[model samples]
Target: MPSIIKCLSYTLPSNVYTNEDYYSNFPDVKSVNMEKIGVKQRHVITQGQTASDLAQLAAEKLFLEHSIDRNMIDFLIVSILEHDYYTPSTACVLHGKLGLQKKCGALDFDLGCSAYVYGLGLADGVMKSMGAKNVLLLTTSVLTKTFHPKDRNSHFVFGDAGTATLLTLSEKENLGPFVFGTDGSGFEKIIIRDGGTRNPLDKNSENELKDEFGNITSNANFAMDGIGVFNFSLKTVPTMIEELLTKASLTQNDIDLFVFHQPNKFLNETLRKKMNIPEPKFVHCLENTGNTVAGTIPIALYESIANGRLKPGMTVVLAGFGVGLSWAATIARF
Candidate 1:
């Protein structure tokens, strides 16, 4: 049996950060090139909300909005950059809260921007694991929390959102021929210096450090090497797309829609130009959502469907890159 994505739903935090909000928040940073950044506004979580909170709410929306039957779900998978606890995975936590069947298998993995496509890969494995009929894949992250409060360069580029994807097992395959790549050397390109076991947090981590660009960060805050990341994407993504197309034994023209992860406007546009992809065939709906990290591609898919860009009998190419210095692409028939 092959795993097929059945449906998708996404939920954004109520709070929003507009271009005006960015200017007002940082008086010294007078202006932003709205055309270049391509983010008019971004939804963000306020208060002490965790990624797991958004995960549960998104699952609720998936069930209520899609009229899904809880008992029908045979397996559950969640991919989050953060966890509700260091021990029990968020998948088990969500399974209990959503009141799934006792026998339903559940697990969670730590992944960032490439999570959605990677989760689908995991779903394919699990579907074959036990002849599972239905699998729930949730990608959630409060990535905005990772940014330094005063880091003007990268703060506005990320937004908080959680998305749920439902996959059903079928005899015919709609998803396959995936190409995955990783370069661990670029790990620090997008990193939180301390928190994990490799470099545990301490009181010193609380002490704020200012950079040459007047940006503020700490061992506990997120910092990205913008230039390094841009060059890495430029070098990696186009090649990954080619590898995926070759693996599927198809060319770019055969693809009906090209949906890649939206990290920011400049990088996405640059990559599109490099790949020579036409504007009409490529999907770019991130003006309102910003970079939702793992949630980016799925949210784009939902909006694309709502606007009639994606329909039955369409072949869509899904690609995701970033945060593990990882990239992956696959072909899926809708």
Candidate 2:
């Protein structure tokens, strides 16, 4: 493993959407299962704010709070489910925003829940193949704006967030032995049907359609097939975990903590029970932030560290699963 995380930091916009606010804003909020999602409140960006803004703030906080030397960062990788533009990579935008050394390399990629794990794997690869000494990995999701106005199915489940993780090449391994999977067939289970080259936004893109349950969205908005995603997770996550454990040569009992993407309380709790993983070892951090897509795992892990739950010298398993029907898991020593 050539990558070791030096610091982790995250930021959320100021706008808070508590359950109370939801009921007040949408009288039909009861149609959405509030308890199952296990979210008390979520922070969403106000109008005109972008995911890159949160990421920039998070990265600035990372540097200032941790006393990180910006000059030493050699590569920057930004992972997002949504981007600020179609041409320029968000990483390049951040490179300019952060004022990093001109020699630094920058790139961006889009992934959903499994993004943090993918970013880590890429960081390690760059350190090994490109000789990047320091890699700045930023994961962000700004999904609130993606929901169609009347979409009850997803409008409540997602919050906006940005996370920054600084990693450096090291002699001893602190991250590695990852198992990744993709189910392109289930792509529609969670997707934004328009705005891509495959389905460019048009006048009809915003035409709202209501489902049988009265939930509404349009081709222009991001959406998810909840039951489909739930079933997909239940089917795929266990096998992925077993493979990850085997690849790392570690048993269930060997892991000190299990950090998975915070999709929802019901779905995650169901997975935990199905896997027979002990309650205390599993991390459940979605009480306040809701599902932040790519930002979930890192934000949860960072919060656990702050709360003294994921202490140093602990052996942890980090797993992320969701949109693209994608999944990834890896064992790490913290």
Assess the local accuracy of residue 148 in candidate 1 as a C-alpha lDDT between 0 and 100. Answer: 76
Residue-wise C-alpha lDDT for candidate 1, range 1-334, written one tens digit per residue: 8978889999999998898888888777756454487888889888899999899899989999999998999899999888888878888998999999998999998778888889899898888777788999998989888777778876668788999999997678899878888999889998998988899999898688887766788889998777788899899999999999988889999999999999887888898898999998898878998888899999999998999999988899999988879988888888
**What lDDT does each candidate get?**
0.88, 0.88
Clashes in candidate 1: how many?
A: 0
Clashes of 2: 0
TM-score to true structure, per model: 0.96, 0.97
- Against the true structure, whose lDDT is highest? 2
Candidate 1 clashing pairs, residues 3+ apart or interchain: none
Query: What lDDT tens digits, residue by residue, belong to model 2 across residues 109-146?
Result: 99889999999999989998888999999988888988
How well does candidate 2 score on lDDT at residue 310? 89
